[model samples]
Target: MHVVVIGSGIAGATCAESLAVAWRNQPEHRITLLSASPMLKTVANFHQLSRTLETFEIVERWLDDALQYPNLSIVHATVASVDTRAKSVLDTAGRRHAYDKLCVCAGARPNLIATAHPEHVIGIRDTESVKDLQARLGSARRVVVVGNGGIALELVHEVQFCDVVWAVRDEHIGTSFFDAGAATFFMSDVKLESAGMSENESTATLRHGLPEEPEETENGVAIFTPHTLQQRAAKAALASARAGVSDIPSSQAPPEPNQTAPAMEVYSGAALGPRWQDQARLHPIGERIDTPRRVVELSTSVSAVLSPAEFVAYRQQHPAIVHNDTDILDWPAIVVLSNNRVYGCDVVVSATGVVPCADFIGPEILRASDGGIAVNDQMQTNLPDVFAAGDVCTVQWPTSSHWFQLRLWTQARQMGAYAARCIQAAAKHELALLDFCFEAFAHVTRFFGFKVVLLGLYNAQGLAVGDYEVLLRVTRGHEYIKLVLANGCVQGAVLIGETDLEETFENLILNQLDVSAFKDMLLDPDVDVEDYFD
Candidate 1:
């Protein structure tokens, strides 16, 4: 049996590792890991925080360490398309790789607001894109961050020494993760948040610092770096030649009139995972300022992205706002928000959301409304012998009451491992039950320098307004806890800071115990909530 995994991201890597370990004794079976970039993301030092929540550090390893499996082989190539009828994948290099089973973990791409202006409008998705943003920020005096997602939230907090114009469509920040109350609670800390990286981030920087250029040793070990210009040009030339079009001189060339672009035209490196911002420096170039350096513009979105020349003409017909109106001309670009306000800035970072990278996937495969390939409970796609996991795939099964799908690393890792098990079971003609991890939704992340743990319908997702009761325990600048209760049972919770209530809360959600007797005591800091039921 042969399995071809199309991506070396967290999902693909985890699935590959699981299969390799399960089939280590079976030498006949072969596994192939395909990646566009040479560097493969691997999960390390994994810790299961709860039944549904797991935490791990993402470690980027080169080919040297990736070749540990004897039965598995890693191929660094960009896939052009997958021919389900032929049971093969065609790479940009015009090579066909045949496989008995296929897993499309191709991951996702950033949904940039301004697709036309790539130079001034940036979307941070991977190591390459983040590096590009860092370069532009080096000389930037002001930057506009647009989005209400995690990337936008983190960028607004991490960036220092330069003014940031944070534009959000929602009235409050972090609409994706937090409710209005939670957002307001975090807002208190946002003003005083430190510019320094977290301790884990500092260690990751020291341990796996990326180099400016690839440094290959005599033994073949090399420090990983972004694709060089020469390599990129060669790929572009190959693609252009395949399309029968002349090579364009400009780096950002448009496709030949009426000519279809090559398959590799939309290709990108692997999607970045946890701690990506740690290594990708976001500090803007300027002297440190004692006061906060951010302007929050709520309930607005970017209506248009304009160059300086366009902005000069635009200001005559519209209005532009800046602290120093005289220096507005110095900005490289101008952003016009939906609220009729305009601001001039050097760069605009769009962290809006992501669209699944399913362009290479054929139309025969069924896709969800969100554009990701839809998969069943077994992680099997609509086509037999084809599977998909991670951000590239959406779970189409009937989910548990408290569990839901989100494009998060925790869910990605879980889906990958479970997909491997399903594949193994299918090969053996056995049944694979839904994994317990899907019983409830749990995620652990950080925001505003505080530990955040979300479990089981956090933020009252999908619940009707005023249908559920909420309880809160807050300590200004320290901790914030919110619990969702319905019908005398704990339905969901948002625990922030070092509250140490995750274990008990997780059990409460899973067990669905009637806590109505002590519901009020759940938020009592003095009382041991865990001991009440014990």
Candidate 2:
């Protein structure tokens, strides 16, 4: 039995590792891992200034174990297409590899604004893009940032030398991550002259390219390091525990060894670590003396990105237009917002979002929300003996009422491991049960220097116009908790700060417990919500 996996991202790499380990003793079962990039990424110790702006160093230690496994070989090449009928995959190099099973985890690419100039605009989706932005930011006095998600939020905090004009389509900041109330909580940080204390500036030299050649052991294990801002926080609970802090924010306890799988490695384009903002030097934009500390333009988006020629043409038509302190011809890109406003900036950061990069598998036949390939609960795609996972695939299975897809790393890791199990079961002609992870949705992330925990339909996602009641508890700059209940049952929750209610709330949503009688006391500071549920 031969299993071939395409793309060395977290999902693909994880699936490869899982399948190799599962079939390790079965030498007849051959597993081949194909990577487009030269190396893989590991979740390292992550530091944060705001929730999304983070930093970390890469580790090559993971490959030592990966290569030691028997009957597993790693290939470095980009897959071009899959001939399902022929049961084979052809790489860009024209080398054909036959497989009994194949998993596509090509991940995604930047979904930039349609009007943004290709050269003047850059999307921060991977390491290369970050380097490009860093190189461009060197002399930039001002920049226009478009997007409302993690990348945009981080950039708002990290830009010290440049004035930022943040334009969002939403009414509040971080609409992608936080609710209006929490968004307001973060807005305060935006008003501060500078966030996170600056330790004398430490220079970060971007690695030129891929690291040293893969070192091979006698056992045939190959090891190498990745060069990128590609980041996913690895140790939070452990970090807090190791630091001897008992107040586990968001009730996030580190998963036991048995529950944790090999960390997903990725090439992550334009991705930044948790500390991308806090660690940056907070140099104000001296060129723009009048620019405020921070400006958040809500309910707006970049309507157009014009080149110097286009801006010149546009200015001729609208002679009375107000302008920022920039020469329209000198700027790389000029942005026009929906409010008929034009601003010239050194460059534009299109941190909008991403779309699946499944073109390698031919025109996508199976589709899901957010341009991901739709897959059943078994992680099986419409193609026979072929599967998909990670950001490239979407869950089409009838999910638990408490769970919804969000295309996050946690889901990627789970789906990868689960996809492997489903593959194994199909290979052996046996039944495969869905992993328990699908039973509920639980996520722990940090934003604006607060531990943010999301459980179930945290933001009332996909909920129609229904009688959804909310319970709120807030303390300025300390913590915020909100619970959403539809009818009389616990449906979702948002936990910020050291609420320590993550576990209890997860159970409430998963178990569908009716908290109608106790709703008022759910967030009572003196009431032990866990004990009450217990």
Candidate 3:
């Protein structure tokens, strides 16, 4: 049996590893890992940078370490297309590699800012884009950030020294991660609420703390603090830098300097650590005054990205809020919003989500509207002998109540390992059960310096309002815990800070235990909830 796995992302790499191990003793079986980027990013710990909403980063690189298996080979090539009829894969170099089974795990791309000067925009998706962002931020004094998802959240919290004009299309912050209630909790921190500010008549919440960037202060003098995740990842990358990078990038690139973009441009795009935020300030008013912290602007969307000339014309039609006569302004580009607001900043960041790159093969491929190849429960695509996993393929199977697709690394790893088993089963004509990882959605991450564990239906996601009753606990900047119960059974929960209720609550959700009589006391401050359950 021969298997071909496309893209060396977490999905492809995991699948390749699983396959190589399974076929180690089978002399007739072969596995090939094809990648566009130079090295595979192995992610272990998952957390957003500085806990404002940034996502994750890498641990270490096993750089061609898969090659230790004689039957498994790593190929550096850009996939041109899949010839379903011939059961073969073609590369940009016109090379053809045939396969008995093929898995497409090409991930998603970043949806960049729509602007005329692609040169002035950056979408921080991969390590490459982030490095680009860090180098540029060193010289930037003001930045215009667009989007309300994970990326935007991280930036609003961590980008120090510069003024950020954060624009979103929602009524509250973090539309992608939190509801208005949870947003309220985080909003308090964003506004720098007093440690004694009265939280909701409900749950208490605690915040986490500082590390370092080995960063320079406002005076351009570098300072060192405690070791940060960024520092550790940098050291690891340097220690195991891949010998050579492939010519093709995993996604699109920013236009080179001096290039003239004729029109507004866009493309799909494509992590963090701590003290990461101390030096950085989140001043929306663009001033360093001692007044009240700025309220985060919401429900506004960028209408246009303008050059200096366009900005002047725009200011003529709709005057600037605070006029300046300086011949040279702080920003080269001006972002105009739907609310008729204008922001001038050094660079614009587009955190707008992603669309899968399922078309790396062709249109004949079965794909979801979001551009991910559609696969059945067995992880097999429409084409025979072809399967896909990870962000590149959307699972079309009937899912369990605890599971839903969220385009996360967790799902990618799960799908990849499952796909490998599916391949083995198909080759042997054997039956395989879906991995239990799909039975429930369990994720462990740290946000705002608190351990965040999300388990099955964490937000009562698909249930109608008022259908469930909520139990609450709060300790004023120490902890906030809410449990959703329906028909006396635990449905979901939102745990902030160290509540120590996750494992027991998860068990309740999975076991579907009735706790109606004890519901009111589930979150009681003095109750030993775990003991009661045990």
The lDDT values for all models are: 0.74, 0.65, 0.63
- Give lDDT: candidate 1, residue 516: 73
Residue 193 error, candidate 3, Å: 10
Report the Cα lDDT for candidate 2. Answer: 0.65
Candidate 1 lDDT for residue 72: 94
Which predicted model would earn the best TM-score? 1
The estimated TM-scores of all candidates read 0.84, 0.78, 0.78
Q: Pick the candidate with the highest lDDT.
A: 1
The 10-residue segment with the lowest total lDDT in model 1? 250-259
lDDT of 1 by residue, 145-165 (tens): 877777777788788767788
lDDT of 2 by residue, 19-111 (tens): 888988898899888877665543456343222122334332233344556778888777778888899999879999999998988777665
* Cα displacement (Å) at residue 450, model 2: 1.5
TM-score result, candidate 1: 0.84
lDDT of 3 by residue, 1-534 (tens): 889998777788778888888889998999988777666655455553211122344443545653467888888787878898899999878999999999988887666666677778887566567666776676666677777766667776666456566765654455545444455566545643211124431112212111124342322222222233235334323321221111121111222122222232322222222222332333333443233222244445666778878777777787633322254244687777665656666688877666576555777888876568999999998898999998778888899886778776667777888999999999988756988777767665555555655666766677665566545555546666656677778877767787777778877887889987766567766678888888
Alpha-carbon error at 372 in model 2, in Å? 1.9
Between prediction 1 and prediction 2, which has the larger TM-score?
1
Ranking by lDDT: 1, 2, 3
